[model samples]
Structure formats: C-alpha cells, structure tokens
Target: MKIAELGADGTEQAYDAMRQLRPHLTSAGFVRLVNEVQRPQGYRLVASWDALSGRVVAAAGFRVQHMLAHGPVLQVDDLSTIPAARGQGHASRLLAWLEREARFLGCAQLHLTAGTHRYDAHRLYLRHGFAIRSFQLSRQL
Candidate 1:
C-alpha cells in the first residue's frame, strides 16, 4: 500500500473511502467542501491505496494550524477505511503518513476526535500514541 496526499487533481477519488466515515456527504459536497471551503482554510486530504487493486482503501483529511492551547498542531478532521479493507493496516498506514506530514510541517501536536461509540477507532488511536485528553461536547443548532 502507498500513502500520499491527494492534490486537487486527485481529490475526487477520495470520496468513496471517506464516505465510509462521513456517510451523509454527497460526492459533490465532499469535493466542494475539500476544494472550496476547506482547502482555502489549509485543509488537505490523504489516502492509503492498495498497490494490487490501485484502489483507495483509507482516507484522512487534516490541516496544520495554530490553536491558542496547542500552538502548532496538525488536526485530522476525518479518517476512514472502506469496511472491506479494515484491520489490514490501511488505517495505520494513513495515520503514520499523517504523522510524517505533521512533523514535516513543524507541528507540535496531532489531533483528532472519535465518537464515543467508536471503540475500535479509539483502540487504534491509543495504539498510535494518542491519549484521551478531554471530552468533546457539541450542540446542534
């Protein structure tokens, strides 16, 4: 498997893998969100592709930014692997790739949030050296 960032030319191809994590997003919306709304804000997309199938098995969306509390941080907004491709190291490869990106960008920290019910993902995060620092609470308007 190969892990790499998906440039504008490759953004559209990330939809399928990403949709596994964000099922509510339409392909067009994902593209627009990445290229228009998010890209302008420093967000980038990366994916893990299976060399044999030449198919994207896992995808991650992240950005490098400075938060008052964390200083320089690489925040991952989405991480997903197609259901059929889970437990095969695709997610781990993507996480490792993201960590390389974080260091290359001079980030002091890496951040991401998993839902309370995401037990498997929580394990993955812990294995990758992430700690559960705080609870995230959200209120929909």
Candidate 2:
C-alpha cells in the first residue's frame, strides 16, 4: 500500500473511494467543487493506493489553518476507507502520515470531527490518543 497525494490523474480513483463515504457528492459536481473551492483554499486530497490492484482504498481530505485559539493546526475534514478496505490499517496509516505532516508544518494541534453515532470511529480516535475537548455545533441557514 502506498499513500500519495491526489493529482490530476488520480481524480477518478480518489473519487471512487471517497464517494462511498460522501455519497452526497456527485462526480461532476465533485470535480467542479474541488477545482473551484477546495484547491484554492489549500485543501489536499490524499489516498492509500494498492499498487498491485491499481485502486485507491482509502482517502483523506485535509488542510492546515492558523487560528488564534490553536495557533497552527492540521484539520482533517474527511477520512474514509472503503467498507471492504476497513480493518486493514489503511486509515491508521494515513492518519499517522497526516500527524507527521502536521509536525513538519509546525502545527500545534490536529483536529477532526466524527458523528455522534459513529461509535467505531470514536473508538479509533481514542485509540490514536485523541481526547474530546469540545463539541461542535452547527445550524443550517
């Protein structure tokens, strides 16, 4: 397994894995959105690829931000491994890579949000030494 940043040629492969997790994203719209919004804001899409199978099995979308409260931090916006790819340590590997990147960038913290009902994900986070420090609340306008 190899983890690499998604570039132009890897779009479809990256989408295949990510779409399973973010089903709300349509292919065309995802492409357009990534070009129009995500890339400009420094969002990066990275994936764990199985070179032998020529497929992306896991993906993560992340970015670094500087905020007064946290100074510099790395925030993982999305993380998913295809159902078939779960339990294979792909997510764990990608997260470790991200943590190293965060440290390389001098980030003071790493942050991400998991849904309340995702108990398994919560367990994974805890296993990775993450602790709950705050709650995130949002409203639809």
Candidate 3:
C-alpha cells in the first residue's frame, strides 16, 4: 500500500474512502471541503491505495494547529478505511505516516477524536500509544 498526500487531481480518488467515514457527504461537497474549508487551514488528505487495483482503501484528513492546550500538534480530523480493507494495517500505516509527518513538521504531538462507540477505532488508537485525554464535547448551532 502506498500512503501519500493527495492533491486536487487525486481528490476524486479519495472520495470513496472518505465516504466510508462521512456517509452524508456528497462527492462535490467533500471536494469543496478539501479545497476550500480544509485547504485554507492547511489541512491535508492522506490516503492508502491498493497497489494492484489502484484504489484508495483508506484515508485520513488532518491539519496542524496551534492550540492553547496542546500548542502545535497534528490533529487528524477524520480517519477511516473501506470495510473490505480493514485489518490489513492500512489505518495503522496511515497513523505511522502521520506520526512521521508530525515529527518532521516539529509538532509536539499527534491528536484525533473518535466517537465513544467506536471500539475498534479506540483500540487502534490505544495500540498506537494514544490515550484518552479528555472527553470531547460538541453542540450544534
């Protein structure tokens, strides 16, 4: 599997894997988010592709931000893999890649949030040395 940052030309290729995580997002909306919303904040789309089939099997959307609490850290906004691609280490590979990127960029830590019910995701994070820091709360306007 090849893990790399995707450019505008590869946005379309990332849609399917992204959709596995964001089921409500339309392809167009995702493209716009990547180009407009995320790009402005220096967000990046990283993906793992199936070498033989040339398909994106997993994807991680992330950005580096300076927060009052954490200072500069690589914050992963979304991370998911196609169902068929699970257990193949794609997500782990993406995490490893992101860790390297965060270190290279001088980030103090790598961060991400996962839903409480996502046991598998939580397990993966725990295995990767990520601990439950604090509860993440959100409200809709």
Worst 10 residues of 3 by lDDT: 7-16
| Model 3 stretches with alpha carbons more than 4 Å out | none
Those runs of model 1 whose alpha carbons end farther than 4 Å from true positions after fitting are none
TM-score for each model? 0.96, 0.94, 0.96
Q: Which number leads on lDDT?
A: 3
Per-residue accuracy of model 3 over 48-122 as CA lDDT, tens digit each: 999888899999999999999878999999999999989999999999999999999999999999988899999
Q: Enumerate clash totals for all models, in the order shown.
A: 0, 0, 0
Which tens-of-lDDT digit does each residue in 79-110 have in candidate 1?
Answer: 99989889999999888998888899899999
Which residue pairs collide, candidate 2?
none
Instruction: Please state the error at residue 13 of candidate 3 in Å.
Output: 1.1
Predicted candidate 2 versus true structure: per-residue lDDT over 1-141, tens digit per residue: 899888754566677777876899998777777767887898888899866687899988899999999999999988888888888888998999999999999999999988898888899999999999999999999
Q: CA lDDT of 78 in candidate 2?
A: 84
Instruction: Please report, in order, the local distance difference test score of every candidate based on alpha carbons.
Output: 0.91, 0.86, 0.92
lDDT of 2: 0.86
The alpha-carbon lDDT assigned to residue 28 of candidate 2 equals 76
Superior candidate under lDDT, 1 versus 2: 1
